[model samples]
Target: MNALIFPGQGSQKLNMMKDFYDEYPQAREVMHRACDVLNFDLKGLIFGNDEHELTKTYNAQPALLTTSMMVFEVIKSKGINFDVVAGHSLGEYSALVAAGVLSFDDAIRAVRLRGELMENAVPSGAGSMMAILGLSPEKIEEIVGNLNGVYIANYNSPLQTVVSGEVTALLSAVDIFKNAGAKRVVQLNVSGPFHSPLMAPAKEKLSEFINKIEFRRPNVPVVFNVTGKVAGTLEEMRMNLINQLTSPVRWTESVKTMDEMCVNKYIEVGSGNVLCGLVKKIVNAEVYSTDSIDEMDKLEGVVKNAEIAEF
Candidate 1:
């Protein structure tokens, strides 16, 4: 089996899905729907807007979702399919859409509301997220445990982990980790600290919003970030998505779990190569990524070869 993974934030770029939008009328229609649902000209921002403005959490959330969906439409149009799917952080929603568990309209609206809520999750400057390289997430957790505050936010990969909480507590923990022989510590440029208790406000609001929306079982199971396991039921999917805001993203665990399930190839159906690079490190398996129909065509032979090898 193979898993098709989606990337999260820090993977977006200007005009990221322009190729798809240009090639497919359906892809353009998706963008039009997003613009109507958002009441903002996302097409303009995505195609041509100020770089810094689009980086805002509110804009980034929807932008990433639309782009991922654009690429997804292109691939599905080509008849490419997957056995399982998973995504990192915000990308989880993209995975859900890809799996046919959520409609584009609902997903777009939910993420729009989600972004606005997350923007106010914590008071600006009250909390932050820091990336610590060259240390296991467990080691980082140990350091956070011994500190006054702060906590693990994202277990991105084996070597990259993020810690979030009060800035003071986080900085102090960073000092301790740095002194303890960590290779590097970098602060992220985010308004609110996510994937930590700092996002309680966002979680509360999102829960209410989620309850109003409808979700169905996915065509294929998705490995959730919060649980690091496959979500098989609608209730489980809802609960996991509700908790995802304030829960650490178990990316490494999810990737490994897919590998253990015999997922030997990974196809990233979205903007960046970040997830593909991480998969290469985690499983040492064949990985593919595409941003356009033309690019996706190149993978047809590769997927075919992999299927033959399995047989």
Candidate 2:
């Protein structure tokens, strides 16, 4: 079986999806629709020279979603399909669109608002996130169990767990993690304390927006970030999305669940290979990422080879 995954923030880059925009009309349509929804020149912002503006949370969210969807559409046009789907953080919105749970227009608008809300949730420099490498999740959890104002934001992989909290707590945890034999603990250059209790305000605001949008049943099962399980119903999927803003992304567990389900291949259809790298650490599956035209052209043969190997 095969699973399709999408990347989240930190995978975005300037000129992302430009090849699709230039070569495929369907891809260009996705970009134009995003521009119309957000009422801005999204194409310029994404493919233009201004890296700083494109990196902002609000811009990055919509841009990444658009790029991922553009890639997805191009691949779908070529008759590619998957048995299940999953995404990380902001990438979940893109996954929903791919699964037919949310329309591209609604997702683009919602993610724009979602980004703005998350960016403004905490005061600048008041909260932060850090990646703690070379530590087991259990050990890291035990170390931060008694600590206040700090929370695990992402269970990315066995060796990479991210923690988010107030600036003071984050700085303090750095020393404690090092002392606990962590290979490295470095702060992330994010706009806010995402996927933490600090994002409660953003979640609250986002819930209202989510309530307004119509969520249809997904065409395929979608593994959720909050629960690391397959969302069986639309209502459950909606709630999981709202809670995901303030819950740690159970990426490792989600991938493990797919592996347990006999998903032997993973295709990351997005801007970067970040999720592919993480999936590699979780399972010994055949993983491929298609972010550009050249990569997309090679995906069919790759999937075909994997299928032959499986049989």
Candidate 3:
């Protein structure tokens, strides 16, 4: 079975899927449609030279969503079928759209507001995230357990765990982790401490917005980052998206859930293979990405062979 995984915030880059956008009419339409809904120069932000503007949380979230959907359209045009889907952090919106649980316009608008709410949740420079490498989650948890303001944000893998909190407290905890023999503790360049308690206010406001959007049952199973498993009902899925703001992303367990579902192939349907690389760390599965035409063609061949084998 094949699982389609979408990447989140940090996976974005300049002119993501621009080549596919130029070559594929379906991909082009996705971009054009996003431009209409966003009512701003989204292409300009993504394809432009202003790094600061492109990197802003509000801009980057919507841009990544649009690009992922563009890649999804291209993959669909090729007649590929993914049995399941999942995404990291902001990428969940893309997965939702892919599963037919949310419309593209709703997703775009939701993420734009999500980014803004998250951005203003805390004062600039007050919150931060750091990746603690080469450490078990339990070990990191035990070490930072009592440290006020420091909380685990992403259980990325057995080898990597991200912690977020007040900047000074986060920095202080970093020194503690480094001393505890962590391989490396590098601070992330994010504007706010996402997926942490600091986002409680954001979660409240987003809940009201989410209540207004219509949600449908997912056509395919969608592994959630909050629970690392598929939601049982549409209401649960909606609540999960809202609670995700203040919850740590259970990525490692999410991958394991797909493994349990016998999903042997993982196609990263986004501009970058950030999620692909993460999956490699967790499961022994064939991986592919839609980052380029060559990759997509290769994935199509793989899908063709699988279909032939089944026949």
For all candidates, what are the clash counts? 0, 0, 0
TM-score per candidate, chains pooled? 0.95, 0.97, 0.98
RMSD list, candidates in order: 1.7, 1.3, 0.9
CA displacement after TM-score superposition, residue 137 of candidate 2 (Å): 0.4
lDDT (Cα atoms) of all candidates against the true structure: 0.85, 0.91, 0.93
Q: How many residue pairs of model 3 clash at the backbone?
A: 0
What is the total number of backbone clashes in candidate 2? 0
> What are the per-residue Cα lDDT tens digits for candidate 3 across 148-217?
9999999998899999999999888877898888999999999999999999999999999999999998
> Who is ahead in TM-score, 1 or 2?
2
Candidate 3's C-alpha runs over 4 A off are none
> Which prediction has more favorable lDDT, 2 or 3?
3
Off by over 4 Å in 2: 305-311
Among residues 3 or more apart in sequence or in different chains, the pairs in candidate 1 whose N, CA or C atoms overlap within 3 Å are: none
Candidate 1 segments whose C-alpha is farther than 4 A from its true place: 292-294, 304-311
lDDT winner between 1 and 2, please give it.
2
Tens-place lDDT digits, model 1, residues 45-158: 989968887888888989999988887777677667689999899899899998888888888888888888988877778888899999877788778888765878888888
